[model samples]
Target chain A: MLFRRIYQFLIVYCIGLTCLLAIKKILVLSDYVIPGIPLILDTFGQVFRGYFFDVLNTLSVTILGQIISIIMAFAVGILGRKSSWAGSFVKVMAYNIQAYPIVALAPIIFILLGDGFISRLLIASMICYFPLLLSVLGIMASPVKDIEHFYIATGRMRWQLEVKIRAFENLSKLTTVIAGSATLAMAGTIVAEFIAANAGIGYSIRIALYQSDLARILAALFMIGIVISVYQGILETLGAQLKTKWSAPKEGELL
Target chain B: MHLECDGLKYTYPGAKAAVIDNLCFTMTAPGFNAVFGPSGVGKTSLAKLLVSRGNRQESCISTFDIDTILYSYNQERLPNWSSIGSHLNKICPIGKETLKKELIEIFKLKPLLAARFSQLSMGQQNRVNLIRYLLQEFDLLILDESLANVDEALRETIILAIKTLFPGKMFLYISHNLMEVAKFCREILILGESTKQRKNFMVRGRDYTQGYTLDKKAFDATMLEIMNAF
Candidate 1:
């Protein structure tokens, strides 16, 4: 099963790469140049190299920020579950954060953090935090009814209850949020790069737009799509494995 | 051990009245007891209050004293039984292997252990839910309509298994099923409907039993008499 999944992922990645190349070729053939611009094909190698490094930069920030945000969310979720007042407070805060538009918040983040990796990290984390936090909180609050009361009555500690019951019961949901947050994190990273970064794919796009280099811009967009798709694919595969391991088989199916 | 709850009063949020009002009851161990009433008479609430030791915030000034109470009302609350060993390990910890093997055999739960709780039929889920509690030691076991979905034969087997295996423990079988109550319990507590009046009454389970079967008509008549007397 693992081998098959890996094979499928490779096939998808290759197909996406081929499509990107094909689009690049079509644009090059059409001589689609902005007015007063020279038709320069010699800089193709430089553009590719720049795009690659920019994606790497953005992804590094995104991955780190998302990991921290997920941990924070899980912690908050547990705290909220343990206490009603804390749960209500966290829920209200999450709601306000979710209601606040990312575009509006972006400028404030830039102004506060001042155009660096810290600013980008903060932006990405904030964008990915609410959805993941809410999802985790919802799963935590989901009552297992008798089983939960049974645990409490049995004197199972909070962490023990979380691991033995909540974690196992809500494995699928947690995986889903992880996948969703990956996409959101990538989007946030790009938006942050567009707003504040001197490096990364978002910065590349900004440069391409300023130069009226449509192909470079297209390449950056395609690279973002590919990165997000690959990330989601990895998470989806992990989710499937978790479900198989933790979830019970359906009726009439062999384990 | 004895289970006791005194002056219990509970009102659901956004509701006009208390579901359980000024209720009091006590049951000693090594006993089979039943709490019965019509739907929405706070039978389930009483079970919850009992199991939680009256810590439910919805209840006003309710207090209960029970060392360990294991309660089950519905199948949906149960965890997936796929990893029965792991689940049992968390709740039982000691003697889990022996208890697991015993329960699987007595309840005929071996076949269903590998299945998800959702995949099992309601009867199967109910049986598993009840068996889960049996693996642990508890002062009071409040099964609030826990066996409603199980078939008669299997339910009887489970009740018999509990009787034989855990003779010293207390079992509070809360249900609207009069026949099951007649067959199992020696004492029955009838919860009253009125919030303003504490009209609860207790009677011997034999009073509702007619020969080999539960006399529903006789039970209803007695219930009516008790309600009117209050």
Candidate 2:
């Protein structure tokens, strides 16, 4: 497991590092020193401190969005399981959400809600809503034919379904959906900031652009990327731990 | 008809040759009846048909109208199937630890219930699943080639458990094990290529009187026979 994680890290790290080097080289070749490397790094640190709550506020929005989406998805999934008619509606709504880019709509949301934390939060929540719903419901609804017979012969009770049946699956599934939603919300916050607020990371990015301070802009962007990565890492670990707990112990794995 | 299927047929979505083809069978109330067939035959399919009834037969059909299924062949939406986890509460369902304890105690699913379905040694879940079904007081209990997944020792324990529970109920016991069929089932439904038929024989009575006529007609020659003593 450790090795698998490291390999995944190396693959992502190499690509990111190579792209940064190529871009840096291009800027230098064009006779743009931009700024000292140390100065860029210090600016990045400043960006982190400047909008730590911006990141938190955005994350909170993403989480709230996911929780709400799950409730909606689960309701529709259960209804679809029963009525067959509802499935088409669920599919249509899901498809419509997927087709329209939430980030593109973030500016409109900011326009409606007005500047700062609340607007960004609303934008992030809207951005995150669909994917979280789709992912959680998809896993919950998927049927495995092999295990059906067991339920038949034993006449498994209704309440018993969640424990032996649903928990293990839902744990991993919701974790993954929440992780994806977090990334979307964070990105949405940045885009929303760019359009509206002058306080958060996105606004900082705009200020750098206005001043022709390309290095500072990159620094702010890089800081946002770091926040996303760190959030993903925390979520990944949370997912794994929840999965381990939910998974029924294999006989050999038992004490 | 307590349990009857005439002109019953089923085919998978994209397969030829009906797993159950123009087959007809029936079972009376208050005892055990075993279904004997080779591995590829429609035993499991038939079991599904039976459980599909007591499970939610009314929602599917007003009565045991097997003809309703003739058109439903290869269709995704069957009349009788229930939604996923219909009984489960969507919000704040109980934890797995409690679920295992209930299944183990109530259904008699012990070590097997404690393991994940994927990690379980192949046949372990069968016993757990079977006992789960057994706990339900359905009109008919369908065991479609059910014990095929269980180990020999556990199979005996399950069979014994079923026998103990055999009061005022019927078992549609499906198996490829011909000797077990002969041993346990008094009324046997025999599925042939051209048609379906029945033969009544007791393991004790057949040897005592009929001189084991089904011995010559045994389909599973190499199947491990359940020793009558054990």
Chain A of model 2 scored by TM-score: 0.75
- The worst-scoring run of ten residues by lDDT in candidate 2 chain B lies at B70-79
Show the lowest summed lDDT stretch of 10 residues, model 1 chain B: B205-214
Give DockQ per model, in order: 0.34, 0.17
Question: What does TM-score give for chain A of every model?
Answer: 0.78, 0.75
After the best TM-score superposition of candidate 1, give how far the Cα of residue B13 lies from its true spot, in angstroms: 3.9
What residue pairs clash in candidate 1, if any at all?
Answer: none
TM-score values for chain B across all models: 0.78, 0.56
Model 1 has a clash total of 0
Per-residue CA lDDT of model 2 for A1-255, tens digit only, reads: 334444565667558656766776777633144555676567667666665665555556556655665566666555444225576577667768778887777666666877877777667666676776566456555653344333433334353463235434457666777766777767666677778875667777788788887567666655555566676777778788767655534335532
Model 2 per-residue lDDT tens digits across residues B1-230: 25566556677789866776666555544456776655556666766665455455332222332211110111111111121122111211346435434545543445343344444443644544454344443555666655665666556555645555555566667676665666556566665443333311112212111222455434232222322211
For model 2, what is the alpha-carbon lDDT of residue B97? Answer: 38
lDDT of 2 at A74: 64
Docking quality tier of model 2: incorrect
Top model number, lDDT: 1
DockQ of the two-chain complex in candidate 2: 0.17
- List TM-scores for all candidates, in order: 0.74, 0.71
